[model samples]
Target chain A: MEILSSFIKNPRKTTYGGEDNDEKIIFLLRKSVIVNINWVTVAFILLLLPLFVSPPLSKLTYMGMRVINPGFILALNLFWYIFTIGFIFQNFLAWYFDVLMVTNKKVIDIDQSCTDVSETTLSNVQDVSSKVKGTWGVVLDIGDIFIQTSAEQREFEFLDVSNPSKVRDEIADLVAKIKKRNGS
Target chain B: MVPNLPIRQLVIAGKIIVILIMVLYAVFAFILTKRVKLMNANLTTPQSKLFERIARIHMVLSIFVIILATINL
Candidate 1:
């Protein structure tokens, strides 16, 4: 369950650098794990390719042996497996670390692969909206939430997140609370 | 397609090339470890420690692969 929550849209508790002492983390949003199907499928196919080719690969000779050498072939296979593992790890890190976080005071969007961050204070968050697409989105409750901010950062598009409407409402609520606090 | 030189030399060259590639991969893994650490510092998550450990393990395994290739290739 802990592992499952790592890929989830709203992790129960999370923190970022420069967070205020009183600021509470409301949401830690990640792009849905379902979106990882693209690279996962590629990695799956690559992992299977060597197995299918092992027969033909075994026939090739390097030196005088009928087969290239069992040891050499095993070493080659080891390299192939390591390469594939690295590919999978890179993809997983990109997905796992890329996140958008909402706090009581601000919103932070991080693109970990690129080491990019975009943030806007709650007071400057002008509007928030959610857009769900297609049949799978409807069934899975997965969609994108667009946050229109009045800060230098204008657009925050949280793509393929679970419970888009709820996330939007929560951020909207934070903005509303901020507005109310200022009025008082 | 026969080689102009000897088959043994060709095998040795191939092994050297593979070792070089594994070394480069090891370097890349080290850089990835650094990047993961930096990101973890940027955003401290519940899974941050787990991710940092995985990155360190990956770096170690990458170096191990280079060593194994040097011996077995």
Candidate 2:
């Protein structure tokens, strides 16, 4: 269709770069699907006890209404519900915003602290150095990628990316190819 | 009976903790903004200033939340 062709011709602009260069990198979600399952399990367990305990407590407090106003207890429950919902939404947005990607020629780091802002860093693949610190990081296969670029005076670090060893290897291979192509 | 002593002591402690957390967050935001400003100076872009403002707002809101929570506690 003509619409599709025009859409392809005029791609959306991104903060990563201009529209023309933005689509070059294939981005990947930082977390695995299993992480959602784990979160769901934890949320369910946390809510289950309160669900069962709250009704009986509410009933008892209602019966003892002469001593204290039931409306106060109801208000407390409303606040608890609001706080829990807000916490869940924050976690979901945090997970959604944390992303990592390997471009053909570089690595991109994206982070979102909350709803309002996002930060990104771009580094050449050749300059990336993989470091796995701490015993837990080594066992879990998650570590930081320290990228020292010639273009930028300071090193840019991508912290706590999963499977850093594999990412490092992939980047090393890509850099070799680029070097070979350039005959450098 | 200790009267309202427990509640008064708890509110004071909460206030102190909230103040300490706010100070720490302010320091963190300052460091991050300084780094962004340095990068922007080299890159010759105004976008870093926008990021610095956003970070400052985040720190302010975080401090506000801690203060509100302490009062309610």
TM-scores for every predicted model: 0.86, 0.48
Task: Tell me how far the alpha carbon of residue A31 in candidate 1 is from the true structure, in angstroms, after superposition.
Answer: 0.9
Window of ten residues with lowest summed lDDT in model 1 chain A: A1-10
Q: Over the stretch B43-72, how does candidate 1's per-residue lDDT look in tens digits?
A: 877878888888888788778777776676
The residue-by-residue lDDT of candidate 2 on A50-87, one tens digit each, is 67756775565222342223443443344344334434
RMSD value for candidate 1: 2.9
**Predicted candidate 1 versus true structure: per-residue lDDT over A66-174, tens digit per residue:** 4356666666777777778889988987887788888777888989563788888877777899999999999998999899988877898889987888777877886
Interface RMSD (Å), every candidate: 2.4, 9.8
Instruction: Pick the TM-score winner.
Output: 1
Question: Best by lDDT, which number?
Answer: 1
Q: Residues B1-73, candidate 2: write the lDDT tens digits.
A: 4343454455447546645655575465555556444433322223345555654655565555545544444
Task: Write down the lDDT that model 2 would get.
Answer: 0.48
Instruction: Record all residue pairs in model 2 with backbone atoms less than 3 Å apart, i.e. clashing.
Output: none
Measured by TM-score, how close is model 2 to the native structure? 0.48
C-alpha local distance difference test of each model: 0.79, 0.48
